[model samples]
Target: MSGFWGVARAIIGREFLRFVHQRERFLAALVRPMVWLVIFAAGFRAALGLSIIPPYQNYITYETYIVPGLCAMVLLFNGMQSSLSLVYDREMGSMRLLLTSSFPRWWLLFCRLLGSTAISILQVYTFLALAALFGIVLPLPGYVAVLPGLFLGGLMLGALGLVLSSFVKQLENFAGVMNFVIFPMFFLSSALYPLWKMAESSPLLRDICAFNPFTHVVELIRFLLYLQINWGALIWVLGSTVVLCTIAVWGYDPARGLMKRKS
Candidate 1:
């Protein structure tokens, strides 16, 4: 038991140290979402009118509504960034070293996911703090309440990164992931706009958005932040996390991994 905790702590510490050294990465994570909130959302607020959506009893400002989505955006980007680092580690052979350690592979992978999720939670809170400063405040309890949703959402996204890194053989090839996976996941989801709005435009697109895992991630946060429960969103997030994590672990398995080909 102690050994498991010790290894997890060491991995988490390493992740934190890497984050501290890369100040720009932290800044970039916050900047992308803040830009959307402060600039783009302001212009769009007047153009797109949101009705009283679930978890929102009254019409809300675009900034206020998008907070959870932006929070998920922070998680999404940071998750990819963490995966980028994994690709770097693989190219440099550090991943093999870490994997070959005495610790069980699943435990080690869990630690990695946990570490990334922890950093993501910190970034989300910092973003929320800035949002509050900018006059987009939620209920005081909402701040505390959002933690689990953030952690779950972060874990799900980070697991996704792990799955992608498992398939991608090189660092340079990640651009395709950004183009195909990241962009679609963000834009097609309920992150920036609600599904009813999409329905007004195209019912098919609205149905597609409903199936997006990122959509549930955002909705989970939105409901938790507003002190509401969305059972559908919760089930979607939980199911997706389980499925993604299973795939990630399988991808990294030596027998199932590219290592079998190389060996």
Candidate 2:
């Protein structure tokens, strides 16, 4: 038990240290969400009207309505960013070192997920603090409640990156993958607007948004921030996490997909 715990700790600790050295990563995480909250929200505030929604007993500004979405955005980007780093680690040979460790490969990867998720959660908190400074604070207790939702969302998204990393062969190809993956995941969901708003434009689009697990993740945070439980969203995020992690483990299996490209 002690040895297993030590292996997990070492893997997680290395990930934390990598983030510490990369100050630029922290800045980029902050910038992406800030652009949405401060710039995009500012422009759209006049165009978007709010009716009373769940968790909001009174009508609130569009800025407040999307705060949770933007908070989720931070996680979305950070999770993917961690994945990007994983790709780099693999190319640079650090991942090879990690994989060859005495611990089971699956356990090591799981530790990596936990570590990246921990950093992502910290980034979410920092973003929230800045949002509060800009006059968009949630209730204090809501902050505490939202942490678990963030963890689950982070794990799901990070696992996605792991799966992608296992399949993608070259470093240069990542830009194309990001374009195909990240933007669609962010825009097609409830991240920027409500489902009703999307329904007005096209029912098909609304349906797609509803099915996307990213939608549930954003909604989960939205409800949690308001001290409400969104059970449906909770289930969707958890289910996706399981699926993605399973695929990742399979892809990274030594006798199979992981070494094929190199061979």
Candidate 3:
């Protein structure tokens, strides 16, 4: 038990130290969503009208409506960036050393995921604070209430990134792959517009968005931020996390998976 905790602490600490040194990474994470909130939302405030939605008691501004989604965006991008670092570590041979440790590979990976999720949550709260400064405050209790949702959402997305890291062999190729996964997931979800809006445009497209895991992620956070629970979203996010984590574990399996080929 001591050994297990020790390993977990070391891995999580390393991730934190790495993030602290990478000041630009922190800034970049905040800037992308801030751009959407400050500039894009402002432009679209008049263009896209929102009705009083479930999590919202009254009509809200475009900036307020998108805050949760942008928070999810921070997690999504950070997850992919964490994966990118994994690929880089693999090339540098550090990941090989870590995997070869006495600890179970899954345990090591979970620690990595946990660490990434922590960094992501920190970035998220910072974004939320900045949003508050911009006059997009949520209920005070909602800030405390949203932690569990953020943790779950972060783990799910981080697991997805772990699965991707196992397959990506080189650092240079990750950018294109990130784009392939990131853009569609972001644009097609309820991040920018509600499902009803999408349904109004095209029911087929709306169905596609409904099926998207990212959509549920956004919904889970959105509801939690308003001190509500979207039970369906919670189930979807939890189930997706398990599935993705299983796939990631298999992908990194030495004897039976991609790691075997790499070895």
- Best candidate per lDDT, number? 3
Give the poorly placed runs of model 1, Cα more than 4 Å off: 261-263
Q: What C-alpha RMSD separates each model from the true structure?
A: 1.0, 1.0, 0.7
Candidate 2, number of clashes: 0
Model 2 local distance difference test score:
0.87
Tens digits of lDDT, candidate 1, 162-251: 998888887889888767888999999999999999999999999999999999999999999989878899899999999999999999
User: Judged by lDDT against the true structure, how good is candidate 1?
Assistant: 0.92
Indicate which candidate wins on TM-score: 3
Candidate 2 per-residue lDDT, tens place, 1-263, comes to: 89989987887898889889999989998887888889999999999887787877987888888888887787777777777888888888888898899889889889999988898899999989999999997889999998889889889888888888888887789879978888999899998889998999999999999999999999999999878989999999999999999999999998887766744
**Residue runs of model 3 more than 4 Å from their true location after superposition:** none
Which lDDT values do the candidates have, in the order given?
0.92, 0.87, 0.94
TM-score of candidate 3 versus the correct structure, residues matched by position: 0.99
What is the clash count for each candidate, in the order shown?
Answer: 0, 0, 0
Per-model TM-score on C-alpha atoms: 0.98, 0.97, 0.99
- Model 3: worst 10 consecutive residues (lDDT sum): 254-263
What is the lDDT for 83 in model 2?
A: 79
Model 3 Cα lDDT, one tens digit per residue, 1-263:
99988999999999999999999999999999999999999999999999998989999989998999999999999999999999889888899889989999999999999999999999999999999999989999999999999999999999999999998877889999999999999999999999999999999999999999999999999999888999999999999999999999999988887667666
Candidate 1: which pairs clash? none
Instruction: Return whichever of 1 and 2 wins on lDDT.
Output: 1
* Deviation from native of the Cα of residue 231 in model 2, angstroms: 0.7
